[model samples]
Structure formats: C-alpha cells, structure tokens
Target: MNSFPVTKFYDSGKVHTTDTYYELLQLIDTKNIAFEVPKMGQKLPFDSVLGVQVLNVDSKASDNNDASIVLKAKYGKVSFLLTGDADVAIENTMLPKYDLKSTYLKAGHHGSNTSSSSNFINEVYPMGTVLSYGKDNSYGHPHKEVVSRLTTVKSKIYSTAVSGDVTVTTNGQAHSVSAKAWTPPTTTPTPPSAGTTGKLQVVKKDLSTEIVSIQNVGTTDVAMAGWKLVSVQGNQSFTFPTYTLKAGANVHVTSGPNAKSGGNYLKWTTANIWLNSGDPAKLYDSKGALIHEVK
Candidate 1:
C-alpha cells in the first residue's frame, strides 16, 4: 500500500449520513487504512503520498454535493484537478481560495453546466478536459454549453461515453492518449485455407478452477499471439501473449488466485472473473473474427 492518507473533508451536519456510508466506513476500518481530515494549504509528504499534493478542502460545512473533497495531484511537471461532483457554488468558493490551474481536468459533475463555469474555465484553462458520463444516460450529461465553453478556450476534450475509456501517459511535461474504443466485427469467422489447420475448440471452462482450456484439433499449428479471450457475461477481455499452439496441443488460460503463467499455462489475471452461477467465454483471433465459445 502507498503511504498516503485517504482524507475525508465532509460530513453531514443536520442531514445524517446514510447506512451505506456507515457500512463503507466500517469496511475502510477493517482494512486498516489510514483516514484523515485535512485543512487548507497543507501539502502531503512529497515522498510517500504518490507525488500528490493537497491544495485545499472546503472550509465551510454543507449537507449537499458541495461538501465533496476537491484536490490536485501532480506527477513531475504534469498536474490534474479532480472535482468530485462539486457544483458551481463550490467552484466559486474555491476560485480565490487556492491555486486551481491544472494541465488536465476531470470536469466537475460530469461536465454539467452547473459546474465548469466560464469563470472557472477561464481561471484554469486546462489543456485537456474529460467528461465522464454513461452513454445514453438519463440526464444527458456533458451539456452542450459546457462543451462549447471548453472549445472556446481551445482545450482538447475527451469523453468516456464516446471512447470506452481514454488512457493517458505523461512523462511529467509531455503526454499521449490511447483510446480504447470498441467496434463490432464486420464478418463472421471464416475457415482456414486448404492444408492449414484452422480448427480449435474450447474443451473446458471450470469456474471452480478459473481456467479455460482450448485445444487445437487441427493438423497445422495455430498462432495464438494477439488472440483474445473474453468473458461474455462480465464483458472483460484478456489478450494472449506471444505463443503458438502446435497440432494436437492444448493451453490453459487461468484467472483468479491460483493463476500461474508458464509455457502451456497462461495467466489471464489474478482476480476472480468466472461467474459462480453461469458464464460463457469467447475466443477471437487477431483479425477480430470469432474463433470459439464455451459455457
């Protein structure tokens, strides 16, 4: 665990917290994680807090979302501002209270117009802004006005609804984006060419063991590199490493706690994925064509 304190800056005064919050606090207590309450202008220890610095926390008390903890984090020269559902009222309260400029901004309240006010946008002038809202959500977040405001300032915008998730890698000063956009397969899986072994089968999938075994039933070798194994129910995928399956050979893709990687055993992850009730698995080739599926 990184030696950073998980700070809590808000608590209900007149409106008490829900039972869910009590349960969450209990879970945090069970984990032995250090939780703290912070004050303004207190910077966390630079060495142990994952290079993040604390700028300000709302000094006044509130019973609504405005009580959310707002923070700034930096790695080398790159900086980020994260506003947790804090609305425009909180933004205005913080404007003159702290140094709010940032390289990237996770727009408040999922880019709703209630937050990201023109005054605040003009103050930060972030290089890139992210709007995080579900696709076809009921509220229709990322309101057009907010997008227009960011555009007016020429800040590059990214949305999780458009791109499933956008990844950012920065060397402190410079940054790059890798979009994890999903697209459907255009054509069905086709048969292998003549004299080439094109057949494979998911012979077994055991939730108890968290392993999916695939056998090459064909007479030719099948390249497994770039292949993907997907959990249909969970909607999670794992890409295979560089390897090839010879004729009549089999490989086991394992997940969960007992997973181990080797020549014939490939570890997909260390977390439990297979459903206890029931789940299906799908195999896709490098060309995005379906190879096989098993329950």
Candidate 2:
C-alpha cells in the first residue's frame, strides 16, 4: 500500500459524520496513518505543491454543519474557496480572520439560505460561484435570497443541477469556465507546473500610473504576505496583506490620488508615492528581507 500525506484534522474528538465512526476508525487503523490537528490559521505543509490556507475549523462548533472545514487554495492565477457546509455563524467568525477574496467559490451548504451570507459573499468577491445541488430536490437548495446575494456581487453562477459537470481552466494570466453533461469520460481530461521555484521579481514600474508590478516568474506560487514594495526616492512603502501570487501571475501595487484595488491590483496608498520623473522600487519579503529591486 502506498503511504499518503499526513492527515490534518481540526479535532479528532469533534469529527462528526453521517457514516459510522467505527468504519472510519477501522480504515485509519488499517492504514496506520499519521495525522495532525492544525490550528485555525495554519497553512498546510503542502505549500510546496500548491498554496493552501485553512481559513476555518471550529472544535466548538454548535453542529455538524458548523464544524465543516473551510479552505482556500490557489494554483497559478485561480483561487478556490471550498466551504464544506459551513453555515452563517461559521462565516461570521471567518470574516475578520482572512482575505476571503477568490477567483472561484464552491458555495457552502449547497447555496442554502443557511450560508453564503451577504457579508461573506462581499468578502470573497468570487469571480465565479458553483452551486452543487440536485435537480428539484425535496429541500430547495440555492435559496432565492442566496441567488440574489450572489447576483448582487455579480459572480457568474454555475449549478450541478442544470449542468452535469462544470470545468474551469486557467493559465497564470487568464481563465475560463464551462459546463457540460458528464459522459463516461471517454475523452475529456483535466490540467501548471514547469522552472524556478520561489523567485519573485519586480517586473515593471510606471511612474505616471504609480504602478509597480510584482510577478512570480517561478513555476510555484509564492506566499507574499507582509511583503512590501518601497519607493526608493520617496522613502514610502506599501506592505502586502495576506495574498499568494500564483506562478507566472502578477499583482500591481498602485499608489496615487486615486489608487485602488480591483482584480489583480492592490492599492498601495491614496497619496502619490512615486515621482513623475522616475523612482526605484524595492520588494521585501515577510521577514523584511529584500527580494527584488527595480529601477
């Protein structure tokens, strides 16, 4: 038998499921698996392969639905927020803890009214949301209010009930989503990895636009939290928040009277921080270590 990666559980005692615990325990014992109970903000060691952030897991969850594990994973330019039946109360706790913004969201609780709160939807700001549910199920999933909320956020919606399967594809720079009924998979299959591992560099600087572009040239996504870009001439710096720059993807740090964040842009400052003539930019990692410098 092939060994698997260490299993990380929120809490062993709190693990609840519809399936019998004895069966699960038997499997675990047979495998002799090693596991861990990670903390709330702990990032799994699987970062080498893909960026994974454990956004939420409550040992004291009031019910099984609330106890679900919520995670946000990023590979290349696409990010996925997978909420496992977590409800509104769980969403409330996760709001202030992490940057929920993502490219795609697997709507929690089958898009039920119990989850996908207005604040949560606004925070995640998903580009596309997939609601996995049954067609004409007894209990109506993807409630009217939830649909309205996602609509207000302007996220493209996909449903399993309508389409047999949904497929999303992306390069580090561009992405597309499509759906089709599932055949026997006689043909279609799914897809990034190729050079250097964690190399990040400041690729471009536009003085007039107050834009400094930072890109991950390597094949692996890099965690850029606490990384900051400094204006050498102005002596001002913009510190990055919790974020992951996917392999070959870039994030623009903008600073000016009208600086703002939308899509791949990150607002550095409202006041001008770059000179019109020219200015050098320096990038630093979380440890205040210099990563790249651009003139």
Candidate 3:
C-alpha cells in the first residue's frame, strides 16, 4: 500500500487515528516509502513526471478545504486542475498565488457553491468541468447554481452523478471526457431564485472564520425579528435582531470574540460552532416554523 511517497500537509495529531493512516505509517520503516508534510508554497518534487505539479496545499486555514491539494498536470499544451474539494476560501487564497487557468477542472467540493465560486470559475476558465459525486446524493451534489456557473463559461460539464465511472484522456495538446453511461441532459434544470421567502438561502459559510450569509430574495421586505439561524451540528443559535431584510438583500453572521451587530451583519460570538463538513444550517421563523435548511 505504501508503494509511493506520501505527502500530508496537516499535523498528525489533528487527524483522528484511522486504521489506514496507521497502517501506512507502519510501512514507512519496513518498506522505506518516503513520507513528507509539504509546505504551502513548496513545489512537489515531481519534475521528472512531465507537467504534473502540486500547485498549493494551504493547511494553515482551519477548514477541511485547506487539506485539499490543488494539482495541475499538462500533456502537450493542455492542462487540468484537479481540485480535491477545496472550498471558496481556499480557492480565493490560491487565486492570487497560482496560475489557475486550465483546460479542464474537476469542480471543487463536488460542485458545491462553497467551492466553485463565480470568481474562481471565471479565473480558471476551464473548457470542461468534471463533477465528482454520487447519484442522488442527500447533500444535493453538483448544486444547480454551480452547474449554472460553469455553463456560463461555455464549458462542457460531465458529472459522475449521471455519468458513472467517468474517464478523461489527455495528451499534452488535447483532452476528452468519456463514460459509457454519460449523456448530456436533454434540458438543463434551472436553479432556485434567491428572492424566495421562507427559503432563507445559505449564500456563504466560512467554517475557518465562522462566517455565514443568508439572503432574503423575496420581492417584499421581510422582517427578520425573532428569526433564528441554527448550526445543526453544535446546536448554536443566532436570534435575528429587530431588522427587516429588504428584498434582494443578505445578512452576514460571524462567530468569535469580535461578534458585533450592525448594518447587514450579525455576530454569533462563539467558537467552533460550525462544522467543516456534513453539517446543516437550519433556519426557523419566530413562530418556530422551519423555513429553510442547507448542508
């Protein structure tokens, strides 16, 4: 199992002890497999492997996305961005430091809105986007908004959700996507609008910073008084102040010692309230009616 060098960016103590990692460690001494914890800006020593390169691994961020390793590989003139579930914050940090433009992009976070932000998508300008997710996932992988974002760039999108076991072949000059079950959707589905009430849209959530945004997309202003935003994982609740969210407006909420309320932002004033993965945000009206939920 430890045939090749293993590179990890995070501290060993931070990870829950897993049988897989433990077994790998055992092999290091016996098999002489190299182990390394690469730094953020270090270039992986893969120069002999042609154009494959590890662009960045931002382990400093206190989010799961930071563990994601962004890789770039080229064959002839074609290049691919294999994003391992990196979210928006990681993408933003990489934008200013790396040449992210590519011919193909493996959409981050399984096409979650938190990863394929508009700015990152625009900067990558991929000719094709490959979404890796299971079919009919409970978390709604390959979210409609993310799909729309890629389409706007005129990029051909292929999803494992529909196209099982997708495969892409690339030479230095070109690339192609192929899967026996893959077929373009006859008609694309439209994403839900932000202007819908009782449907508080979770626009952004930064677990590293504990910042979240919810928008009021309804045509009329909606009074947010008594409305509550709850972190399903930690059971943390943020009660809305006496404020009315105007149509097409959104509010930003943060958690920490610097929690403050002003204008369109609210603070939760806590720590470790939001889970980095697989946690839902539930919204309820003053009357205790469940309004919206997102994971």
> What RMSD does each model have against the real structure?
14.0, 22.8, 11.2
- Alpha-carbon lDDT, every model: 0.72, 0.74, 0.70
Report the poorest 10 consecutive residues by lDDT, candidate 2: 188-197
Q: Model 1 clash pairs? A: none
TM of each candidate vs. truth: 0.53, 0.54, 0.58
Score residue 67 of candidate 2 by CA lDDT.
61
Model 1, 108-197: lDDT tens digits are: 888777789999999888988878887754234666778878888888888888886877799787887776422223465453232332
Instruction: Tell me how many residue pairs clash in candidate 2.
Output: 0
lDDT tens per residue, model 2, 1-295 = 2355545433424544323445656666677765465667778767575788878776765455666778888888789999988888889998887888899999998878878999999999998899998775423466777888888888888889888688888764588878742222234222111112278999989887788888899888887765768877544566676677899999998877668898889886666667665678898776667879988
Q: How far is 99's C-alpha from truth in model 1 (Å)? A: 2.4
Counted clashes in each candidate structure: 0, 0, 8
- Put down candidate 3 lDDT per residue, 156-220, tens digits, no spaces: 88878777777778766666778542344658655322232444677887766677888876677
> Rank order by TM-score, top first?
3, 2, 1
> In lDDT terms, which candidate is top?
2
Best by TM-score: 3
lDDT comparing candidate 2 with the true structure: 0.74
How much is the lDDT of residue 51 in candidate 3? Answer: 71
Which is better, 2 or 3, measured by TM-score? 3
